[model samples]
Target: MTTAREVLDRCDALAACSDAPERLDRAHLTPALARAHGLVAGWMAEAGLRTWRDQAGNLCGRTEGREPGLPALLLGSHLDTVPDAGRYDGMLGVLLGIAVAQRLRDEVPTWPCALEVVGFTDEEGARFGTALMGSRALAGTWDDAWWDLRDASGTTVAQAARDFGLDPGLVGTAARRPQDLVAYLEAHIEQGPLLEAADRSLGVVTTIAGARRFLVEVVGEARHAGGTPYPRRRDALVGAAEAIVLVERTVRGSDAIATVGRIEVEPGAVNVIPGRAVFTVDLRAATDDARDAMRDTLLAGIAQVCAARGLGMRVTDLYEAPATPCADRLRDALRAGVVATGDAAPLDVWSRAGHDGMAVSAVTDVGMLFVRCHDGISHHPAEAVREVDVAAALDAFTAAVRTVGATAGSGATVRSGATVGSGA
Candidate 1:
């Protein structure tokens, strides 16, 4: 049996493998990532699995089943962290997968399918501004342009891969064919307050929200604040403020979330009307069509604001990922796991935050189990998960895997890349 205390201690140990001494900041392919890789690989070997680093620098461990060449049942998550990250987040899922594999190894050394865990190198997009590099490669969706993506110090991803002793040309080898696996399972923190608000420790994820991001720039002529009268002034910042308000209002009217996470205004002088205003819009919804509709409405609203203020506006699409739904079979399995913990009815919530599960889902049916975190805080130092919740999560996660195995044996066909319900 894996105790929550033991798992929490492991989380603390992995937290030490960080670039910052006072905070957690492990980026992709850095020395700190290599150190973390060593630690996780050692633990995976201790759990009776053969461990190796994939072509894309994803750390993988595999334990064979009754037959040596069985399609693997993938389990794990990323090991990278955002700047000043908490101890858990992506790290907890990897540790929990290891513990589950260890427990199952003790119970049933050889099962129907191989159990594999992968600690993806990059999922935070902290260093290169592109998330799910590891999982995307495994899903056979590696974009060639990503090789040119640079870090803050101007190091290309290809160069960093070389520095990390990996060949960029071989990244495609990381991909697994759709028929090469049973299914993908990830256990992650809810990263929200829903479970805690509902007073539950665990929940099955219904879907992960799709996201479309944009870089919006509002351009206007700069003028002296004191010299330019209010009637004659055309401040880009003012126009941007109005546009932001419109964006908020438009998104609020729909079942979507919109945020202006970052903004910058030109003309350093306090006595100058801004010539340029730039900001980022992160828009998310349960479905692609809904998200696109909200985006169009928000853009039209921003254009109106700019037009009325005599400003020129430009919008650049940064990224777009469609919503992903959990498979019905896996959801049923997770529900059974929750019931095994005495929760007859588990809350099913939508994930606003993105995960590697999103990328992996492109190649296979993906399922996610969520454990409650304190106050829904994530990507910060204050993020915390309770010990009791983790214990229950461990129990539930292990049971979920068992249920998946049982379903596979019962001739319940689970086709790869198939979903239980329509994504909305």
Candidate 2:
């Protein structure tokens, strides 16, 4: 059995392999990723799995099942991180998957299906500003246009791939056919306070929220801060502030969430009136329709603010991903796993944060297990998880794998008593 301390230790070790000195920041194709792969690959080999770097830069480890060539059940999560990231968001999932594989290799020598763990390379897209590049390749959703995407240093994706010793043109080799696998399972931090509030160690994810992001620029005439009359001022910052407030108000009553995570003001001085304000809007909901409704409302509200303030507004789509639901069978297996861990009824939570599962679902049925993070904090240095909860999660995940193996061919679907919520 794997101890939670061991897992936590590994997470700390990985956190140390960051490009940033004071914080964790491992982006795609950078030297940091090479170091990460070296360490993780060593661990994978120690777990008795053959390790390899795929064409799309994802690190993979595989071990055979009961039969020599059975289709593999994939257990994975992204290894990349946002700037100043927490220790347990994506790293915990990949490490837990490796731990689970190690347990299966040692104890269940003749498991029904092969087990594979993958640490996806670029799920965060912090470096290139385009998410899921790694999983999208695995899902056969790669687009040629992404090759031209440039980073802050103006390094194109193709150029970065070459620097990382990967052939950008051959990324297609990473694509896995739908028939090649059984299903995909990911265990990740809840990144929310719900599970901690419910007093549960782990929760079964019902759905991943559909998300859409836009970069909105509110442009207005620049005027002297003191000289301009209040009635004649066309303040872009004020217009943006009102639009931001409207975003919160409009989405409050619905099963949706809207956030203005980033904002930039031009002529950023105390004395200068801002001529332009650019901000990012990230909106998510349980369904695409609801998300679209929220988007429409937000845009309309922003338009009203812009018009009243004589500011010109422009929106550029940054990213969009549809909602993904867990397969009924897989959800049953996870619920049973939680039950075996002494939780009579597991909470069914909707994920507000985007995950690689949303991309992997394009190729196969996807399921997720979410363990609570302290105060639901993630993507920050203060993020934390309890050792007891991680230990419980390990027990539950391993049992879930066994349940999946036993029920793989039975085609049984269990209607759950899970408290399914539409909003994240």
Candidate 3:
């Protein structure tokens, strides 16, 4: 009974909880995130589910199945966003989940698996620069080194967690066992032009691209900008600029997707010769082998660029995720969902963009439903989706849930002895 209009309004409501008054800029472990959670938790509770904030900062809610304490078939998406992001990318999926909760609030005979939704805290990594922290933690893939990672304001993850009322020592307790999750279903915007060009309302995701991120540093001696002669000076910014050109030129017409999104230079004085330049690289490809091969060539090219510039070079890896293929069983359910929406056959597409499903795949099967956005615009202010398309997507998503739920043993939690969502 939840209309698409309500979902859009809710997204706008969440968008208002941003750090900047001028633009939408919500990030992880911030006051803005706390406010967003407070709003969403209420929505989840009103939809007939018990809600809680997981130790990893993910907002979660669930309702029991035919009996109490069944393993969960998960739904929902991240709530974080990039700077000045379009509201629908992650927000729509979450609001849709709440709609689904409303749709099934009074189940005549509750399905085998419990229904749970999670609004992940940090999928964009816009704040910490390391994406999928929330999903990875839920998948039991926590990295201790992340505690040392700092934000632009030099706030450590531990301090931020404490500031957000989370205990660092107990962060590990957020992990959910493999047996505790039956599956994870994420409905998201296509974030590309293909769906729109094809004139489709929805599509099925076959795989998610593998991505590797690195911070490459070019070091040079700092000297007086005016006094230092051209031959004597080693300008890091210049060196980094040259290397970044190589990054673009190398992947210009290739199947791989590469970007140098962020760069920073040392020496605050504008007149001072730059001593160090650190730039972030986000490299992704359809397959792991292709991605790695392209990375090897690209890094070698960067190293050569630094050597030619007579600069010290260091490459520090920020993150890496292997290409994740959708589970066939889950994919089938999604396909069936799309078919039920009057699409005789669903267009199967591989995602060029990264998703939290990549991290969650380790814990349970993962599948995605991609709704077409206006011209595939995302991460920008103009991102958009149609109400009719959303309504269709909702119908398909509900059918997919039933399709998977039907496979569960009669009155059983998991097919095996697995216990789904046994976490607090």
Candidate 4:
């Protein structure tokens, strides 16, 4: 069997040869991104697997099993990276799937179900303003409304798809039928420091956190800074600052988190009193109720602050994604995989910062295995994961595939509450 180091070496080689860089400033996929996709396709072909592109531009590679009648086990993750993202973020999952298929072909010989690996496209939402575009298409969630979205250069998604040799009209064909897949698995870098901080090798995600994003606007009269006394002036920026503090207080009071990540003030002359201010509020929680409560609290707090400052406040919800629980059967299998290697530790817990696995889990029984990332920093140039941790994650994922493959069609329903073992 090829060692994890050998697999990672291959991944590193691809990273170097591809146009994908650690930053997004001048990054363009026009030519180099295509080359990277071709490299992955070539690798899949060399592994003796059949490869093809879906309507949404996802690259799929398949390994048939002894019993071809059973629904296949799907392993997938996007190959595209965020602007200035580390090479490992989404690439590891796709390459690891290939590695697992190679291992199965050499050792197991025959299995009950087939194994399919997919490299999803445009998952970062960096250039197109839409995340999970490929997966959503496969889930039959992509709609016509998004077709006209233009990038910084005013190029539409449809136009970009055509430029890349993909037919926009056929994108809907990417959705998989219910009978075609049994379950899905994804191996990814934790993109956080929790695992490393706890000295663990892997993380079996239990649930993906639900998220709510809002835009808050505070309106007040513009006045000269020198002419307006503290009591006489209704400063919109001041009201916005108070609302930000109130949002923090409300979230801290409940089991939720709210962040004021972006803020803007209009009429930028420093000497004049600002007439209006805008800010974004991002809230996340483990459950839908908690998230909703956080939103309500933010709304109330903003209103109260606006009334107190004699300003008008408006809140608009931009987006909301509900929490998605991981598959019970797959969770148990992941636990068993950890125990099988004897390196398993007590399970550590975490909620996703953004949505990816949740999008897949909504449509299928999906599982995720996380490798510890350095300092819990991601979507930046310094994002990293340790080599040993990566190997451990591969081992756990392999065990999971074996467990799921072995019991594909016995009509044996795996309960959601099954436990694997302790965390590292």
Q: Pick the candidate with the highest TM-score.
A: 1
**Root-mean-square deviation per candidate:** 2.7, 4.6, 4.3, 4.1
Please give the range of 10 consecutive residues that has the lowest summed lDDT in model 1: 415-424
**What lDDT tens digits, residue by residue, belong to model 3 across residues 96-166?**
98888878888613677678899998899988878889998898898989888999999988899999999
lDDT of 3 at 382: 96
Poorest 10 consecutive residues by lDDT, candidate 4 = 415-424
Q: Going through the candidates in order, what is the number of backbone clashes in each?
A: 0, 1, 3, 11
Candidate 4 regions exceeding 4 Å error are 17-29, 106-109, 252-255, 412-424
Q: How does each model score on lDDT?
A: 0.88, 0.87, 0.87, 0.76
Q: Candidate 2 regions off by >4 Å?
A: 106-112, 223-228, 265-276, 307-314, 412-424
Candidate 1: tens digits of C-alpha lDDT, residues 1-424 = 5577888998999999989898999999999999999999998998888999988999999988777866677899999999999989999999999988888885434566778999997899899998899999999999999999999999999999999999999999999876667778999999989999999999999889999999999999899989989889889999999999888887787778999999999985798999999999999988888889889989988999999989999999999999998888888888999999999899998888899989988777889999999999999999899999999999999999877753443454345343221221
lDDT of 4 by residue, 1-424 (tens): 6568876886676566444454432122345556667888987887667899887878898877775555578887777776666767778888888888777765333766678888887777777787888788887788778789888899988888888888999987888654566678888888777788888878887767789899999999999999889999889998999999988877887767789999999887899999999999988887888889778867987898899889998878899998877777888888888777676564745565654566665456777777788888877767777778777777788889988876775544222221221111
lDDT of 2: 0.87
Flag clash pairs in model 3: 180-419, 180-420, 180-421
